[model samples]
Target: MPYSSLPPSAFWKLCRNDRDFLLSDIYQPKFSLTPGMRIATAGSCFAQNIGRYVRASELELVDTEPAPALMPAETAQRFGYGLFSARYGNIYTARQLRQLLEDAVGDRLHDCTLWQRDGRFYDGLRPNTEPEGLGSEDELRAHRLDHLRRVRAIFDTADVFVFTLGLTETWTDTDTGVVFPTAPGVIAGQFDPDRHAFLNLGMGETLEDLSAAITLIRELAPEIRILLTVSPVPLTATASGHHVLRATTYSKSVLRAVAEEVAALDPGIDYFPSYEIITGTPFGARNYKDNLRNVTTEGVQRVMSVFFGAHDGLAPVDRPDTGLARPSSDPDEEDAVVCEEAMLEALAPK
Candidate 1:
């Protein structure tokens, strides 16, 4: 009965219900994000939400690869323009992200990771960036080169970098072990079992890959702070042959753990609980659309509100359901979360 009976964080016992507990600020960031800070985001498709949301706020979200001055908004988004700091689309794994920067700085080319469709070539790394295929193999190469140069510039100048970890399962080239965001044929490449292999990364490999990514980013931009979040959206399909439900659990668990390990390495690195905010039991899955995989607009606002609260000296724990945004059944909506992994289902044979 005495106050000495329990340890820290046990205050949840005081809550008569779960919602009160879920709103607590699990994130106390080591770095502050203020207006004019150049925050470049990457990683899973869920990350795309940050750019849209931050632009609507006071923070200075940088777009290193801005669309041509008069480019249409819809057109700009489709060609992988104005999405992240660069044109790189949905970097699903840490190795893919690390290798991207590696290629940018050292010119360690992985050019063979390309796909051909109807006489046009696509960057296997970002097959969907170009809605159609590039005019020629040379065109693909030229665009990729320019993208890399901007990526390097982004890394060198950003005050903060945010990345969302999406999955642990990936398809890679058997000979070279290069990772692909989607299976080859799904978007543009031919899926060949002989040439391509499936890899379901474990905690150790994910940890190592992320460690390398953090190290490389810090080495290039010593003052840049890193923020990492695991996407809460479930996997659309699994090559691991496990039920998507089980696969989702494993994938998220590995990423969440590895993120913590990486964050412990540096004071500037942090892991935000966007994944937990939506997936946590207390929220009761209120954040998902009917499909249960696509996070709703309300959910994105909810997550970002919590994000703003913990950083930038904003109020941290108020859960007023402000109609700050509207919900959508459509993933194509502007400011919608862009999760290319969802394409796996649309690719399934009817």
Candidate 2:
């Protein structure tokens, strides 16, 4: 049962926890991270944790989303949480991210235009921002060219690309073949069967798409290392119609398999089993929060415990200064109770 006695190939399986083992042995700051490194993250909500963790560790985390002027709590409440970063917008699957990259690269075959409606410009893919204006065809083309330039700039400056591969099924534009984070119906529009098709990418298809994405990233930043994780959060809904619960299982299974396959295929790519660390049977089943859905702090701690154990020498991060001070408990103060309650509730939770 000794860890050193295990064969090198069997180490990951026999380890008490892979995340901790990998962090301690392979991903320590001394070995895996260095000063002045720029890292970018995109994926599910769990992926946001990477940004949070890195920032907490006093490492540089690039924020690609436009920040609002309001305070963090106000911004989060108004935006439904995790503002100052693009969190809620579903990057549900790797294919969706791949398409975004393709669009950014101008390799997309479709003639797409950035349009303005309600005073903001929208990237037809995810309507995260308002359209600036509907310019002439030539003007719109120029804008897209500028947008792509900015994306390329970020890609070039990043030292690590942390992408969380979320879902395999996605909704694509019928005529243009552009992919959407959620199908038309789920968020705002009608689901036209004729125009949209569900993509349940098989192993080979997923590998090819991921490989292509890696190639594209290398073209932009040759030294970038990709860390891919399968989100452990269960799906809120499934298009497969095989009972929502069953759909969650099916989706996670496919994604986990694809992640393992892709990691095996490339040396520059690494797989982190954060999904298994939290949801695997080894942790037992009662670890979720009251909703019996979301993972609890204990669950998170278990994952981080493994992570820290693996990366043994990382100095503990100093407490974060979110720049928003703790609200006073004075009842007469406007919004004071809100902030106080928020702080209390966060700490009150087990």
Candidate 3:
């Protein structure tokens, strides 16, 4: 065999054997995260777990707009504190993330996207952002405006932004073609087929949306290094007619492809194979909890371990108190994963 046959990563232990691939070759990070680096996180619920791991590690993980100190801890969780830099919960699609940035930068508007539940207005885009729902239309507008402003600040200044791409499945407004975090009926409004439609974003559309997001980030924060990862957790349900398993495969496959393609577009952009680390059969699927949709404690630890190890000077992060790993244990600190899509399962007739 010629010396040119392989690259430097091939010699690493995890890559030395066929079954041991375990992401050693594909895991080389484009840049390193240091002790004081200002790391910000967004995207799906899994991205929330990433933020917790980073903070527990005693690193400088920045949360630009924290919840008010006087708020009850449980109130804070329901309102989406410590979930991400901003309170927008579970941006499950690339289009949602892109729109979030656009909204922050004042390039777009979706004020009418709010949903009414029994006459109470909930920012349908951030339905979980206010657990009790906002007091009035004026209050909702004020809160969302503040969130967008803080989102802009978070993106404009964070040293490294880590986003875990989640799902291709989405429900959108049929008439306006606007995307919502979940179908209006599931959480707040009445389910009207004439008003709502289902969309399973394909590879091309996902890539285009992601590319625009990266471009906007660069425009706002040129030096911001991007660390993209696909959430390993599978979809809870499929809006598409395909079997749930098949739908899960397709969603993850497209997200992984987009992460690779978009990461290649910028020198500072890097794709972390946390998806492969968990889903790779050789890993024995140890990363997922019994439900399989929720990631386990050990899984989060291993992913962050690989994340820090792949870099040059990052010290390992400590495991947070178990309370912070799952919402069931301690609602305030964990991956209070605002999984709105899961509500669709109840819609099925027994």
* Number of the top lDDT candidate: 1
- In angstroms, the error of model 3 at 147 is 1.0
Ranking by TM-score: 1, 3, 2
lDDT order, best first, reads 1, 3, 2
RMSD of 2: 7.9
lDDT agreement of model 1 with the native: 0.80
Pairs that collide, model 1? none
**Candidate 1 residues 1-350, lDDT tens each?**
87678643355655325544646556778787776677889988888887776666666677888989887766677778777888888998887887787888886557557678899988888887886988888788888888888888897678889999999999989888788888888888898989888999999898888888888888889988999999887898998998889999999999999988888888999888899888977677788877777787678878888798777644333332322255454643433444567778786768
User: Model 2, range 1-350, lDDT digits (tens) per residue?
Assistant: 57668554356564445533333343322236554466777776556556656556534666554445664754443332342134224366767667667766874424442334444444444433221333454554564555455556667667777787766766777777777665554323456788777766666767777778778888888888887888776665556657757877877888888887877777777787778777766556655655445555456555555544444344454323333355534322322111111121222227
**lDDT, candidate 3, residue 111?**
52
After superposition on all CA atoms, how large is the RMSD of candidate 3? 3.2
Which lDDT tens digits does candidate 3 get at residues 12-78? Answer: 5536465656454567778867777888888887887787787776466778778797876556666
Q: Which ten contiguous residues of candidate 3 have the minimum total lDDT?
A: 324-333
Deviation from native of the Cα of residue 183 in model 1, angstroms = 0.7
TM-score of 2: 0.72
